[model samples]
Target: MKSQPSLDTSPKVSDEIRKTTCYMCACRCGINVHMKEGQVAYIEGNRDHPVNQGVLCAKGSAGIMQVNAPSRLRAPLKRVGPRGSGQFKEISWDEALDMAVGLLRPVREENPEKLAFFTGRDQSQSFTSFWAQNFGTPNYAAHGGFCSVNMAAAGIYTMGGAFWEFGQPDWDHTKLFMLFGVAEDHDSNPIKMGIGKIKARGAKVIGVNPIRSGYNAVADDWIGITPGTDGLFILALVHELLKAGKIDLDYLAQYTNAPVLVDAETGLLLRDGDGKQLVVDRVTGALTAFDQKGVRPDLRGTHSDGALTHRSVFQHMIERYLDPEYAPEAVSEKTGISAGKIRAIAAELARVAFEEAFELDQPWTDFRGERHEKMVGRPVSFHSMRGISAHSNGFQTCRALHILQILLGTVEVPGGFRFKPPYPKPSEIHPKPHCKVTPGAPLDGPHLGFVHGPEDLALKDDGSPARIDKAFTWENPMSAHGLMHMVISNAHAGDPYKIDTLFMYMANMSWNSSMNTSGVIDMLTDTDDSGNYVIPNIIYSDAYSSEMVAYADLVLPDTTYLERHDCISLLDRPICEADAAADAIRWPVIEPDRDVRGFQSVLCDLGARLNLPGFVNEDGSQKYDDYADYIVNHIRKPGIGPLAGFRGNGNKAGRGDVNPDQLDRYIQNGGFFVEHIPAGANYYKPWNMDYQNWAVGMGLYDSPQPYLFQLYVEPMRKFQRAAEGHGDRQPPNHLRARIKLTLDPLPIWYPPFEDSHV
Candidate 1:
């Protein structure tokens, strides 16, 4: 009674704040997870972080539910029943490792191509791709091919940078914004924040998409055009701009291949006797090396050097797009926009881009050491996403959008589509894909890389594609991201070849991901005449019980977001802003009560089990204990590791030695590190020496040559030539003509499939 009367009351302690990145989706928003009594209390976007700036999207906000969902797989599971019955029994990690290695090792020894490893929504692509290559499988791809490869490939090949975070809109200065098919896209939060800025500044916002929601809802006007016809719509805009003589001549002359003369006969770049590209001098009308100094190029004219009859690419453009078909009146029925409205929008675009140009007072020097007192900008900016990229004509459609932007000089200017860090690499300067097949040994390089011509195709001695998915072949030469959507069907049909195992991560292949969900489910469970499963085995990793979980032969349960170590590295989709070159990491804020392991850690463990080349030390020991050890010590190159910050002996970032304290440095800095981009290095980076040096220093580019815009893509032309039986890597007879058509160097407009049939 006396003790009860004493009544000692204790107050609850304040919640501890643990900073990390939100991995709910691929946005990688910076978040601060508040810990109350050793439990997650709440999560908020980091106030000082550059990517989100204290704000988060719905996906980021819903991360707690995503992590703590009841359906999350908590332990390693091996199927005890038929494949799709979802029957499973928990097993130790050691047994799981042995099972995976037992299934995969023989395939690697006898035929590595028999193993196809694909990933989806995975942030650690470099890791997975590296593993796939070391495991000696030529079949590997991320989800980008069916998602937005058009956006990326088109931007990279045409303008030197593409949208999935490689470039961004200049929200601070853009006056007229024309967005196509970009309602809710890859850059969700940053786009939301950008839309807010553009709106607050009272700039004109025009949505060129069908739906009027999300970003479209905030638009001052929604064009509501028909889908898959944006290329035609953009061509109409170009037609009107050209008819009205609203062009950026100086920008074209200095920045693009518009002035680069092409062989009128061959449809190829005009080369001089010494093999350098030739350009016609505007003042002298004489042919000169395109790289010649003091050469003023005439962007719009035809000239003859008495031998080749060359014409400027600008003149070629006049012949291609200044047609009656691209006229608004001609495409109105297809685009669902009136002729008058299309012309009016085009005029507005021209006015904002050319007449209402933006200029900054910062003085800078170009790559050629030419000094400029002010920086010039086109105030019109454009961005598009899945709506334009998912079509069969998507590649050219993306090219049309880039052509429109380049014509307006809206690339890398004060108020234009400025490239993000590690971009503006010599246009489409991709290395060859690793296709050499061997037994029980890794390939020479990463499995997935760019294929410039037929030589890069994964072909057998008979010239048929060696990879099961048929990526980088004449069927889809520009499939920089392999066609992941075709894998399940192809494997089921054994169209290319049968595979021993189909290893996928995070993708929901059995459900909404399939165009025909029921068909995919059937394929997943399909059996052969021998009464054995056609696709012998399936291995999948998922944090939650997705539709794909039911079909897996082995399930590697992944840890929740708050209980894993992850890196949003510069090598694979850095979470950087337009103004900030940033990357982030996440360490366990709360220990997992369950037995789930992070996918990256599992990958490392599997790599160690298989003794894949890069995963072991010179002494044949496990090189990395786990993902965290790999992140801290696995050098991507001589001076670079996963985290770019806190690197080097001096801790000087961008170029650095692997600081053992790199992970600690990231944690101490509130979970992210961003170096302030200097004012001089922020814009006009295609040739800005300061920006180029910084970019190269950060290992974004191999060399600092001034990156010229490739309006005339030579690599595509090479593929076309190869299709015509003129090169080492030629397509099969049936696929040659088709390759030639799709690999057109210049952008062309064609009707969508339905329109063509109708």
Candidate 2:
């Protein structure tokens, strides 16, 4: 029967296959697009890709539909009817570009701060932010504020790096894996593949989430904890672990701030005249800097300077966590998990981390000149996402999760969570939020970054928020990612200040991207007594006609992801692996049939038209022809550019001069570049000398930035001191009490504000 029914099974599926990186979502997987007669016929994953390794999600596979969808914007459009009326007139690119410049040029020339430029789900933030900086707008940020900034900010503040895109659990050797509140929509393909690997190895999986679907469904154990109480639950685990002496004491003293001395009366770390944190060396029975070679820090050491007594950070931790308030029994009702269950989980974590500890015979040196004969491993790992971060108490809760990992000595280890390249960079090295905008000039520095103290807050002389979204203000002092969700509403209400133009990219603020959809629509359409739009003008860019397009006065249409040139840069959100530093590019596999341009390329043209300093050469000529030209020729630093591979004569890995054939080299190598970490530098990356040198050589750092895990975050205390009236830049009366209560230097759990209303 089979022989009789045999058909032309060997018929070709396509005429050719073109490889590129998929942009359907942030995963940035590599895909092989099969073309038949110069049109896309099918799509599959590239087996050699580091991110997914031949695994493609439903979104990635459905990218063909995205490119060929009939709903795509055919050309730029100008609003012909009232806002939110869904009426428009198609126009040429020249008309659209002129209109945009007409609205933006005045704002840049007079007061650049009047232009609020924000982006949503944007992959090219490094380039886009540069454009905004040159335009001199402090009111600029990506969608992370509304997406996952809490997780990112908390991780960067506490451990120098965060999970998800920045790092991942070591799937090959982990014995116990615990996942908490991870949305199934994020990093989908790689995580699924990781879980499959661990499951095949017969490892134990513990899922701690409110829902029992997706990854949790396949777990060996599930703890259905209450929502918004994750911090309390984590604190209880910390209490139990501390009480039972089940933590990695040596790891804490060697690699964290556990041994640093803190002034008991002032609640601040004790530092020398040069601002180096002081610690007690038990071996020498003397106070010294923490980084001194051969110093054995005493976790229980203390000193009295007559005026004030100082105690070790570990002693404070013991006092804080050993309290009855954080005990398993005390938090059982709030967390909705039984005391026995909490204790059991903590015990299991301890058992896997200590009793089952293993080691590799790889030798390495530490920043303090200490040498290790073998790389010790603690095979316990954990991960979490938005469920624990998108709440009022999210930042502290995320901090608690990091503290838990540090306690178990699992982070940056052989069988635990590991950072990708260009990470493990402490907050001290990151830029401070800059709001010193000058008319007709670029911003003083980057718009979005880490804020160290009240002095770093973005505020005017009168203490008003300097940004449209109120970022880096007394209201939210540590907002590493500016608040994009507040831009439209703030501009409409003129809360801090009014904006002449609300220029956005890709984000649909009138729809799911916003908190109040109906209210946002009204704000966009709302008028004052003079019958003038409150927000003045709006410019938007998107590939498809999303719901937000109706409210825009000018809509710059964009091409599909398959029809653009993009860089997944190491300078931006790279596609690096734990063991290898990597980056990728996406070039047009097929040309767009519509009269649209890539949003980034359009920005290049607009920047040049506006004569933005960064976009124009000394003679007033356009510096880049398009996005592709920028990717190849734009030098961010002396030797560093967007892509880190095939640089400088097409042979350099990290730092080199611009190579003209860089794109061609990437295409030949399957649209990505990777350089594996040396064996001795692969694990324990934060304090390991080998890894530090490797990172510097790769241009990840200018010098070896070996740092300790910040178990005791002192920057929080700086804000607390300001609340206590100890600083010149003090918080307002309404915010003072709240800041004092919430900004504890150590991790503390409190109920979400919604609990009070309930």
Number of the predicted model whose lDDT against the real structure is largest: 2
Best by TM-score: 2
lDDT, each prediction: 0.83, 0.91
Q: What's model 2's TM-score?
A: 0.99
Give the Å shift of residue 395 in candidate 2: 0.5
Q: What is the lDDT of residue 592 in candidate 2?
A: 94
Enumerate residue pairs that collide in model 2: none
Model 1 CA deviation exceeding 4 Å by range: 1-14, 272-276, 301-307, 511-513, 754-758
Q: Candidate 2: minimum summed lDDT over ten consecutive residues — where? A: 509-518
Off by over 4 Å in 2: 1-5, 510-513
